[model samples]
Target: MKLRELAHSRTGDKGNTLNVSVICHDARHYEHLRREVTAERVKAFLGDVVRGAVERYELPCIGAFNFVLCEALGGGVTRSLALDAHGKSLSSALMDLDIAAPD
Candidate 1:
């Protein structure tokens, strides 16, 4: 029910920006993910944890949605402790996504 439970995250540093990729499992829930998760929502969820633009990508072959969080590492990896800026954390954020189990 969390991002940690639903998918894995990879963090990268590009200049003063942090690039994070949230790769979801159970590709079948892609539609639910698309409907429930949005850049604005993600920004609200992440809050000060990371800043910048959020982009969503759907990979039909993998049935996974990839979220690219830009400039979220708080001035790059060196300065970030990777804390959840909003208290909900990434896992909690993912849990917030409305996903339906296979019927």
Candidate 2:
């Protein structure tokens, strides 16, 4: 199953960093997502687009996870030549992640 089936995401950017928040549709799925979505997994999935470290912050209270991706924007929005310099599309991309169906 795709992560999109269980959650949605929001994205923000600062300089070369990207922040992606994944929020579960159902709070009960939080633990499952926490187990499956790790900083290393996210970094690997994003590939070279993310040039720096990936950090995951658990938000159990809100059934969400916040991922901070460093050096991902090519540079800041003003400096980056990429069309999606703010990386808004990254949220959609992240939703494509594959995960085992919740038991």
Candidate 3:
């Protein structure tokens, strides 16, 4: 019941902030994600990497959830010495998030 089975994600970054948009394959699953894919949940999932705050914006019209992660890029892509400074793996990693599968 991983979220990936129901949705896909896109990610981008601007300095230390990163944004990940989770788009549901079908609009019907919006409510399910709204309940399970919470900001707190995402923040907890990402853990200490997010130093500031996590905010979620809903796009019901498009059946997508946009998660804005603050201070997540370590020290900005240019400065962070981490091998994956852009945090591209975050999207794939987040796909492992468990969600309730429809019956």
Candidate 4:
């Protein structure tokens, strides 16, 4: 299933860091996302989208995962040449994760 169908995302930009919170629609999909969405996958997905090194963490308390992508925002918005840094790039990149569909 599509990541959008499985979860909702909250994205943020702090200087060169792009912080993303992915909340799963259901707890059942947590393992699927956790197993499939690795740091490598996140890095590759965000390569063109964010432009940086990615660090992903799993949050058991929230049943969600957080991704802190460094140097992703192209240093800053003004320097990014009007790119829709958080909205366009981050979401598109996260969508590439091969998360399993809910059964």
> Sorted on TM-score, highest at the top, how do the candidates line up?
2, 3, 4, 1
My TM-score estimates for the predictions, one after another, are 0.60, 0.98, 0.95, 0.81
lDDT of 1: 0.57
**C-alpha lDDT score of every prediction, in listed order:** 0.57, 0.94, 0.91, 0.74
TM-score of 4: 0.81
Which residue pairs in model 1 clash with each other? 3-91, 27-63, 50-72
Give the alpha carbon lDDT tens digit for every residue of 1-103 in model 3: 9999999999999999999999999989999999999999999988888888999999999999999999998899999987889988888888899888865
Cα lDDT of model 4 overall? 0.74
**lDDT per residue, candidate 2, 42-79, as tens digits?**
99988999999999999999999999999999987999
Using lDDT as the measure, which candidate wins?
2
For each candidate, how many residue pairs have backbone atoms clashing (under 3 Å)?
3, 0, 0, 0
| Higher-scoring candidate on TM-score, 1 or 2 | 2
**1 versus 2: better lDDT goes to:** 2
For model 2, the stretches where C-alpha displacement exceeds 4 angstroms are none
Residue-by-residue lDDT tens digits, candidate 4, 15-99: 7687788888888788878877777877776667556677888996777988888877766666675558545457655765666
Q: Where does candidate 1 stray beyond 4 Å?
A: 1-10, 79-103
Comparison by lDDT, 2 against 3, better one: 2
Number of the top candidate by TM-score?
A: 2
- Poorest lDDT segment (10 consecutive residues) of candidate 4: 81-90
